[model samples]
Target: MRLPFTHSKQEPANTRTARKLCWDSRDEYFRCLDRIGVLNPNDPTQKSKINANCANEDAKFDENCATSWISYFKEKRVVDFKRARALEEVNRNVENNQQAKGSQE
Candidate 1:
């Protein structure tokens, strides 16, 4: 089942990424429900149902609310991805240099 507050198919990718992060947070909002044995994690619609419910519970809940929550998670993920990308780039450079040196030898 879809979460109560989850966005519809029309929602943008950036919006989806943000919501996914919030749902994935340590607060375990989603995890708690999963561990409690309520919803199936494998179901794509579950998250949407949960989000929609959360949105309904709070009078202030809106697209912007989801947007803000998702933004924080998105930012953190982006930073982590950037760091990983940088490390990978460095490793690639080092490997290339080693290969070049080995060829010279």
Candidate 2:
């Protein structure tokens, strides 16, 4: 499930090192997920797949990031992936349109 992205001024892990740790763990976990083609970490249907494939990285990610940030980061990853796919589609369409125009000239 995707959560709406939000910007919060109050971050519990405000230190640079803590933020880095969270990001590192998150990246590792997401890499594992990507390998298994799992998008939503919180999805109950994907829990077994995640546990079997990414238990170690998932555990580290949970340990490093705050409880609030865990869900936020997972949801944000899905949202970001979808956004990037949409952007790519838009770019492809624009390129196709330009090519068509050029061919007509």
Candidate 3:
């Protein structure tokens, strides 16, 4: 996983073990965010919430991941939460439509 052009042998992505640690930390942090009902960790208003609710998990994520990857994960968490909400909405609509049809029959 070592990049040829850079001297990043010490980089997290250069080794599978480091990547695993980053991913695990990211998941832990995101799970904490979920528990706190926070979809956007980078929001200014949410900063205090995150600090209060998930400071330890956030610290682990920051420790394990590279700076570039940390930002990427933060942005991706919002997108993932939105996607899950959309899926739930669509499923609910389908179920309501089916129930309505059943009642009409």
Candidate number of the best TM-score:
2
Per-residue lDDT of 24-104 in model 2, one digit per residue for the tens? 999999999999999889889999999999999998888888778998998898899899999999999999999999999
Between candidates 2 and 3, name the one with more favorable lDDT: 2
Better of 1 and 3 by TM-score: 3
Question: Which candidate number would show the highest lDDT if scored against the true structure?
Answer: 2
- Cα error, residue 21 of model 1, in Å, equals 11
**lDDT of predicted model 1:** 0.51
Question: Model 2: what TM-score?
Answer: 0.84
Q: By TM-score, rank the candidates, best first.
A: 2, 3, 1
Model 3 poorest ten-residue lDDT run: 5-14
RMSD of each: 11.7, 7.6, 3.4
Please give, for residues 1-105, the per-residue lDDT of candidate 1 as tens digits.
334455562232346665554354523443454454534333456666655554332222223235555445435544765788999999999999999999999
Model 2 RMSD, rounded to 1 decimal:
7.6
lDDT of 3 at 77: 78
Give me the runs in candidate 2 sitting further than 4 Å from their true place: 1-13
Q: Write the per-residue lDDT of candidate 3 for residues 1-105, one digit (tens) a residue.
A: 445646442445647898899999999999999899988888998899999989999988988888889999899878977899999999999999999999999
Model 3 ranges with Cα > 4 A deviation: 1-13
